[model samples]
Target: MRSCIWMGSEEKRMAPGQSGPKIRLAGFTKFEKKKSKPYSYSRTAKLLERFKNRMSERKDAFGPQVERLTVLHATVKKIADVERAKKHAVEQTEEVELVE
Candidate 1:
């Protein structure tokens, strides 16, 4: 079997059971390959430094908020403990009265 692929003004053929599509490089089209630009080490370094600075600033900004949340958590836990103690005491008194 054979398949046809249209590229620009030419029709390329592909054989049966082929692993990949056959591309013809013998024609000129509207699309042309351009040379890739060179990499810049200084630009990459500046970007990385900026990213690190932002991360540190975020940590500093959230530090106080995190500490306040921790303090609130401890306070809630202490209140829960007191409530549990009161509940236990009430249950114990009910049990003693039933025994008597």
Candidate 2:
């Protein structure tokens, strides 16, 4: 038995009792797909550099954002410690008020 398969813009016929995969052909249409521009060597190198920097910035695979957050947390903690120490020192020391 002969079989016909409808391809992109053409029809494909199969031999009698021949079981085969249908082949598709590229067809031209009103809205043809736009071809992508090839990446230049410099552009590719820049992309690789950016990717490497991002990967290196990660701390122990915690991710870049996590690394940033950790740094921020450490800074805040340090500031808080300093402020606490200052408050403690002020409380321990005597402060005299001037009489007007």
Error of 1 at 64 (Å): 1.1
lDDT of 1 at 95: 100
Query: Taking the tens digit of each residue's C-alpha lDDT, what string does model 2 give over 1-100?
Result: 7778878899888889988775555773346678999764445545555555666676478576655655555565566667668887776664432321
Whole-model alpha-carbon lDDT for candidate 2: 0.63
Alpha-carbon RMSD of each model = 21.7, 20.4
lDDT of 1 by residue, 1-100 (tens): 7767888999777778775565567675446779888534344444545554555577777676556555555565566667668889999999999999
Q: Judge candidate 1 at residue 31 and give its lDDT.
A: 67
The collision pairs in model 1 are: none
lDDT of each: 0.65, 0.63
Where's the lowest-lDDT run of ten residues in candidate 1? 39-48
**Total clashes in model 2, counting residue pairs 3 or more apart in sequence or in different chains:** 0
TM-score of each: 0.39, 0.32
